[model samples]
Target: MVGLVLEDWASPSRATASGGEYGVLMYCAKIASRAGHTQRIFVAEFRPDSDTQFVSVGIKHVRFWTLAGRALLSKKGVLSSIEEARMQTMLSVAFGANNLTFTGTISGDVCVWKEHVLVRIVAKAHTGPVFTMYTTLRDGLIVTGGKERPSKEGGALKLWDQELKRCRAFRLETGQVIDCVRSVCRGKGKILVGTRNAEIIEVGEKNAACNILVNGHMDGPIWGVGAHPTRDVFLSAAEDGTVRLWDIPEKKMLNKVNLGHPARTVSYSPEGDMVAIGMKNGEFIILLVTSLKIWGKKRDRRSAIHDIRFSPDSRYLAVGSSENAVDFYDLTLGPALNRINCCRDVPSFVMQMDFSADSCFVQLSTGAYKRLVYEVPSGKQVTEQAVIDRITWATWTSVLGDEVVGIWSRNADKADVTCACVSHSGLNIVTGDDFGMVKLFDFPCPEKFAKHKRFLGHSAHLTNIRFTSGDRYVISAGGDDRSLFVWRCIHAPH
Candidate 1:
């Protein structure tokens, strides 16, 4: 771990923290700004094994600064303001409806938010911390699942109806608490559940009533599970240090790969032609589905790879590691070619990372909680230095543009951070935070929309954020309020 504790800064300063995302070790340097803003710079290290020496991965000394402040956008170097809020502990986001959802604990209850507005939807939802939530393909229905029950017993899963504002469907009696939950289109009607006991259960609707049960090896908890988009096939990873491929319809294990390290996260390439796995021991491997051959000789690094994604064009694989840098490899060339270290003067862990649909740029969340952009091909910083903290998660908006949009920190006139999102198109943005305040930002010109204005309200800290498909709504989840909120994006007018 490589981070610094800021003892001499302002009231709300930053602390640098570092760890392995899977196997890589990233170092972050965090610093505070005049307006109580924070920035981070990330450096990455990679290696083949414990005995071998570490390689630089070609990402040393590069710097990234905040793009949200006045210094970066001064008349000499002008940009735009898109929204409000400083930072968020965002939880979950879903596609299709152009929605983003967040989850967090507030007074022991679960809260949800949409578009910076409080949804007025409330529920006791869980006895303990709510771990994950999902929105189904069916309109207006959401699913939330948690592991620890109120009684400290087996956990439960609940289904809710957004329009009706009630608990519509739920399963309360699974013997073991759920380790992970996945929602995928399996034929006409089945939901797949993976439990802590290394078992897979398929819950189907009446029309597709085929309750499939699958059994597999290693007594450890399951780490991750995912299903194919067009097919019913699914894949699972476990702490027992194994990855299993299952065919849902047959309810049988298709193949197994014994990765040397305990698997942390797994992802299928967008084309479904390959699978990428991040391990606990600071290594990442790419495997061909057909031959199951491990690709590129088992690339090992010093830090863990927390997030793995294939670019939209499927030509490059972007990896977000415990180190502050984001690395990319050409699918055709088979090794990392480019890397983005933490911002200049800002050294911190990368809390989250995402690539735009066109793969031209990347979004980064620093350990200090600040968010910024890096032009892809050139690996250049887009914004000025700004500060944020405790940034848990972030995702790219689905709207089309050469520009990137997502939630970020909004300090306004204070030193605290709030949650906000920016739209590169309208140059407009919105934000909300722990104070339950939501604001809209408009620029003097559509080209300069990165500024601020308070617009809505919430009762607690902002947990998750995402924009709707129509670009007209933003969804947020998880707060002290224990409710879901959806805000309609009001155009500022031409």
Candidate 2:
């Protein structure tokens, strides 16, 4: 059991700044000099033995350093910095057993990367900051939605061919900057796109038409959306403190739940029998998918929950928030798995989080100046380093087909990257940044794990990353630059 410690990151820093508010403010002003300064990544990890540690990445090339005062491996390069204004968001998807597809925002352009090569495969896909993008399970294509330049006109939604070289090969215009895009199962050959203005559009190969203009959320905008994995049911959480379940085939609202707090994130159980929601009040609510019955609720209202995810088995729910900890609870049983704080090492204000398929571990992306990782079943810290930027979990794979951890990084102490995503195999992770470049990271299998791979590519601030159902490809959505990039997994090490 892990203890939970919640704190506000923006609180008065006077007490910690050695002086008063003015002193702290002055300190921040001085450090602002380093705000845009560039930095590169250096890697150090514990071996399977946990005794012999290795360090790599140096000034000229990757080389090796010491564990107990002995050199192992170390590598280095002068990675250029993407301008602050171009960084937007990053998203990722798993395409193969060992590859990730990446998309990120860079000042109105979207770019895609294959691995961590610090180069772009597809560039300049959108005209504004790409806020979100997603991929359909049926095919390898990607759909992206983002804000357009001038800010006056809303963004548009466009479709892309993942195999292409430059941005989206064939883009279907939605005529508006869509905050989010959800692909709902539409029977024969169609998908649905939900927009910022609450409009649902039906898109297919031949025709794309406006389906429904949802007149919900009078007080605020829609922030999150998800579809039931098994049924035609969809869930949407809004700033209005409500979660609505819509029956896609029926085109009707099934159940509208007033969670009594601003809903920031929502997810369906893998079985599609329940919906898990994270609220602004720092609580989580579970609703029966079919009956709309409230089965359980967990309230901690001290910090805002930024994301929530259910274990693949639907037995546990993981909550990520502005607080420095991640809380877990057994949904099949009772009493949430006592919240786990990453001690002082874990940063605060997480932006997003994901659980492996087996729910054995959790990867959290933080706004707290660093990222953290935790073992799920036991709620223990697995890594000793603080991530200086955003990260995402793609998947889990093992020799027994058990739990394997997959992750990707963005804003890696260098650029102002925003979002990111991963696949299911735990073999590949993709990232994007402000430079409008996408990069890929591959995890090689240890003799103990059965497989492994290295990562490459990308040159911008990545905003978003998402993996497909089969975990064979990744779709990336960029921010600052309106662009959408897709990368297929070139290899799957099974």
Candidate 3:
């Protein structure tokens, strides 16, 4: 909340509404950006106060902050004439030799500055935007990561000497997507590189081989996730056009199948033989879990499939879509048959659902905050209160269920709670919301504003969450942060 409110992060116009008015505070002082596009602090470094006190960099702006008595003050960095001609928003800042400051720019250039004035620019220091840099005197050089020379190749890495003039560049092993580097770190006799797609790589010194230490969805939001029926494996489908299987114990991505079309939802069968993936193009495909090959594919309509679920008995497949309908496929005869039925008549698009423990009924939560009940296979709406109450659900994901009515805070909007999941033992619940919070609540939280503990990590919206197979941990995905987090669960927390 450092920058002035704007229409959006990329906009220059100020917003009419402010976030808060210093609630729960007696007195406070703050400073905000006065002019230019919205700026988000990328990095803040602490150093002995000199002509350059504290340095921070962000979108299109750099500010040198200093302590004036008890008051904090910041001055904007001034670009030189030539520097202004090829201006780049600073991406990273680091302290160099002789009280000088160096900043990496979006244009792949490095700017050497004295105090608040730009001194020089080393052009094309990197092929694309320089994301992160680490300075180490042990190596007597600054290590940087950015876009690779060719977009298809991996990111560009550089080791710059003290003078900031000459450097050595390293090429990462090529991958399908452009490896835009997001982080760099000094390791034991090596360098660690983190990419935008969540791949963690290790490179040995000078012309040596690079090893991929970790892997994930190369890019895009990951909304689809499924836990293996009885193992430590997790299935994740991302808009990166790949559905990846990850080993939860070893933190290694095991196997992946590229769907060409971006995938949005995924579900592993209760029998653990195959998985169903829903794509952004409204198509749904079934793939063998072991080999990662397409078992079957179909599309009932051409709209993004928001969610897909397999019944606990492994007899039914339900695909929820943005077209305001739920497509049902009878899998008892094997998934290659005609559609059993399509459930409709919801006021809004389908958002989430759960099948009864017996697979005879389903509970649906629509985008409009409506919770409705439907009979499975027949696709017929179920309105009898007695029947709906007696049904035992294998899962509890719909946000609007009566048993979980206490999850909603007073005056909370309908769309605030994006996702919720129940632990296997049915003793606890995990939920994600628009505020990027993952909260834990007691099962069947029926009291208004039920007591809960919130953990914050992701940015923007946390769109999905689920408990691991053993109920030992929970996995959550951020819609905007593009990050998947795993949290260990505590059995008892009063």
Candidate 4:
């Protein structure tokens, strides 16, 4: 695992020139594997006498692949294959009534897994990258919208049956990129499609023709579109920093409100009584559904809001930001916006977050490498040593001395560990490395680790690593390989 070290010192020479003291902060990060390699070093000087200015004198170097001079680990896994494209646009996880979790990758594949084991993979569901996916309420049919490939004719809106087989495809004439697709209601036979050119096209399930096309936004591209749960009303937000509500059947604008910042995302509460708008300027506002008035507003100057979601009970709102902070607000209390708790100081930006079915916990994932779980009301961390327990088998050499350490120091060179996860019991840990390998390690291993096993399936950088709820298996995903691997935990305690 990579380590960060920081130190501060007083620069006597610089102090003498300015007739005052100045501090120099030194940050050193080392990626020590079986092979000796230096990754990055950063140094900053702070001068408080003038304007408290900070100047940096360091270059960042990142190694995405393994270094040379090391023996490769043996391949290990029950299943391995290429399943999707190189680039992915989105990912959605849905649960069935039977407790089965289905993951749909925007690379145009819908995969069904049972406890980290791949049960099925629906290949080539769309001709190109899928932008949005939704399941209908009647027969659980999946609706997908995406841009067509260059070889293809135009963009498509497709519907899949219960078994994930393509049932119908709708041909669109606009030929614009579909940014968001949503179903108006259960068994309504009407689907709403938002395009990058700020147009909202309503299409019917039985026919391939557009029912209505409305210019949703005038200034900028539409970022989000949401439908009301019980009414024919829908909401759209755009880069113009405005949120507008429209009536579908009436084909007219119902209300409009400007948020004074670029509106990046919007969502309506499941109860249909409130709406949340996330802005790009680190501000978010809550509006009343009936009166369309601002209920509350808050801001985080560190980063912009990326996504917003409400708990299953519609009582708590989870606001994820680019600064790795997740704030939970209690909606039961009035316009004061009582902040129940917050999960802050994470390692990376919070790309997506979801509340548990019971609304007791929230699960969040970052852009590159971190997955965290925290209790809702108490804001207590549920993941035990997730970041520090990651163990990489590599040969790490000391810069000033001849000391060498790591799990594979005796046999192999070095590997770059990308992501990691610890089991709920805190007895085991799983790590994904740049060589597309997933390895399991015994927690609290000796300095020269001896107990470890490898799971090899991906042929690219392993971007994600996760453990099943029961810690029975490990789920991993590759970065450019576009493949999802499910490995059975052979050493899981029985």
Candidate 5:
């Protein structure tokens, strides 16, 4: 086994109660392989009297070193880059089964990563921040839309081929901010674009000709658009507190349902039989597709509903809110809309969520650090010490306080889990942290300090982490780090 050392130095002005300067430092050591172990060490210096903390790191075989905190690689791990300006924020991400990942950034660049490494950077792909992105049915084709800048025509739609090369650009004459875009038609040759001006623009990918299909929302901006699975119809949710269903072939509005609240997002069930709408007032509603009759509706009252998605099987609807909670509703429960589970008190605003492919679990991401996973139908939290802590409380209370006071375990470390996801099999989970560490934990982590594997390459807070379809690898990105890292996983016994 190789040994790792850590050192800390404190300034003389920051003396402790004992009249001496004090500091805290931690070190971890792991076997590199079966032989020729590699040693990695890091030293952090803290001064209570100063506003800054300094860290230095070194790694043996990789020959990695860092001075101060600005160097690319530190003793922690190798820093990956796309040879472009540091990304401001990761606005959108898309994955391909071919091991290709595409990310859009606030810097107006679209980066493509293969096997978790940055392979291509489409620099300045837009005039302003890339707000939305979509991947076509064809493997390599991607569509990106951005906000308008002061001097340049913004809200333009651009298409790129597989090599991160721009193939076509379509400029929207409406000058409205494009909020969302989707591929329409069976061949994926046409695009559907939604704008804040309450317009749904349908344009051809080859000709780039814009045709206004609907401009009916008179009240407010349109936030979401959903295409029907089998029909030439689509649904649009607007801040006007209504959902409009339009017939593409007829070039007219077929129906409009007043949801009574500003709708932020709408999603059609996989079978196209139901539509779920999320409102700005935290009201979630479900309606039958054909009749446009309300099937069920519920209000959370805590915060606005930001997103809603249906499980792959259309068995459940997951609602995410700004209040840091995710509610799972079993669609088969009818008028009761029977909420099977509620994951509440997440560290920050719930920004995104997705159900496992098997519909066994739901994964959620927050605005801050940390991700959470919970079991479907059961509502049991499978991440952190939530479930186990409850059990421990019950067991400990059953015994007399004096009998177990001396034998209790130490407190678990506090972590602001920002974003998390469970594997398809529901066997493993990966989470990103505010400190830029991506950790792998066993499902339903029974203990606060459960056995976990850590991957440390990012030097900034991690914004997103996800497992590949087969659960063979994990892809992580840090907005501050401006890079993506992929790690291979060694299966553990369930």
Candidate 6:
């Protein structure tokens, strides 16, 4: 969950950063910085029953280590001088019965090693590169995931007996696309596989069919996310050009549709029947929530649409663009947009906006550090304290406000705190920041340097965050990681 850039040789061990990675426990409190690829260390494990014996596998290198007191002894794995075997890169390793260590290679072969010496190489263990291997600790079986030949369909989760003979395999294709398995382990008598597409699927021992237990966005910067006005489901749109609908407790992806455009912002209509999607191409479209049919479409500007909101009364739609304009559309005039006046004279691009409870006004926060209020139909800026103070917002999502002034640190940049959402009960406000932190603070926190609770489980910055209908859970979307996290509400008594 690191937000900072990756550095080489930072720790003497020069361990590979964990994005192109997974982690496991090792025997040594101190690591032996052995030579391998400069960027990645794939897997490390302690040999069965011996604290002194350890194994590590990575690109083009596999090493067995012997720890004696403070002195760590490492022996580079030996492979036969076969011209092709010399080029094989080890990606996964697991221990077998009687201390035999099996390392999966880039050429789909499993090299069996007994005490640092290469014993035998099992050919065609997989079609493509074997990315992961798990020993069914209870049974003397090895599970490997990779591609299968002939058909070339990837994501082959196969089980091999003690003799390394193939027993069975399952290719878990998700929605017409083969999902490559990233890691594998056994759980509760079933096989649990974590896929490269960010899905946790469980396979039945007897049935080859796999059930997806969890799923998420796959590509960078998932900026568009909005909860259903009254239901437990939520929608997320991403740079991958996908709009996925997911449920709360089930954590299952209910449905998804790709509109062929990278969506930047999304909002559910107040009545819950329509969804408004703002895209990277500056076009915003409305879709019928249930059928996902295009209800309306518009490309009012050429720049990206930064934000979109539907009035609480469901009569108007507001679209804020990177061009520093907020355009209004009358929803009451049917599918065709009745172009109302546009709000201008703002200093910078509109980053966020919300309508008043009565739908007469909208408050927008811009990139240039301005939070301005504008009358809805007239599109006139309002400055009078008496008028602005009396407005009740339908939603509070702006990051720049008197209430959220504490969210910014004295040294924080404008992009540091990207998104914010207040709770339904108005008890607290949660924020997503560039450093991948989710912070909780008192609502309307005007005090300078306000105290807050920080939660870190996302990589890079969070693009968007929203509390579900009851404020029972918080959904946070990642920027570089393409991960969506759901956090439960744990508020302290005021």
TM-score of each: 0.36, 0.41, 0.81, 0.35, 0.36, 0.84
Superposed model 6: Cα runs more than 4 Å off: 1-39, 81-84, 148-155, 173-175, 187-189, 249-251, 338-340, 384-386, 490-494
Best by lDDT: 6
lDDT of 4 by residue, 163-208 (tens): 7767877765554445344322224777776554345677777766
RMSD of each: 24.5, 22.1, 7.6, 24.9, 20.1, 6.8
lDDT of 2 by residue, 416-466 (tens): 444443345554544444554443445432223222222222233444554
Model 1, span 161-263: residue lDDT tens:
6542545334533453354433222333555555444445666544323343644544443444434434656566666688877653353667778886777
Residue ranges of candidate 3 with Cα displaced over 4 Å:
1-90, 113-121, 137-139, 151-155, 165-167, 174-179, 213-220, 332-337, 453-456, 492-494
Encode model 5's per-residue lDDT on 1-494: one tens digit a residue: 11111111110011111111124446886422221124432222222222332222222221222234433333322226645434244555544446555666666777665544556777788766665666653555777777544334334577767776677767665444443342222135788775554456788767767776655564644555555655656677776787877554454667778777788777778788989998998888889887888889888655788678888777788888888778888777776876777786678776666566577766555666355667775767786555423321100101011222221124513334444555545666666666756666555454545555555555656555555445554545454543334454555354
Candidate 6 worst ten-residue window by lDDT:
3-12
Clashing pairs in 3: 197-218
* Selected candidate, larger lDDT, 2 vs 5: 5
What tens-digit string does per-residue lDDT give for candidate 6 at 400-469?
A: 8787889887799878899999888887888899987777777888976677767766766889999889
The TM-score leader among the candidates is 6
Q: How well does model 2 score by local distance difference test? A: 0.48
Q: Model-by-model lDDT, in order? A: 0.45, 0.48, 0.77, 0.54, 0.56, 0.80
The total of clashing pairs for model 3 equals 1
lDDT score of model 6?
0.80
What is the full ranking by lDDT, best candidate first? 6, 3, 5, 4, 2, 1
Model 2 misses residue 129 by how many Å?
Answer: 34
How many Å off is the CA of 203 in candidate 6?
Answer: 1.0
The candidate, 1 or 2, that scores higher on lDDT is 2
Show where candidate 1 strays beyond 4 Å: 1-212, 216-229, 246-254, 297-300, 335-346, 384-494
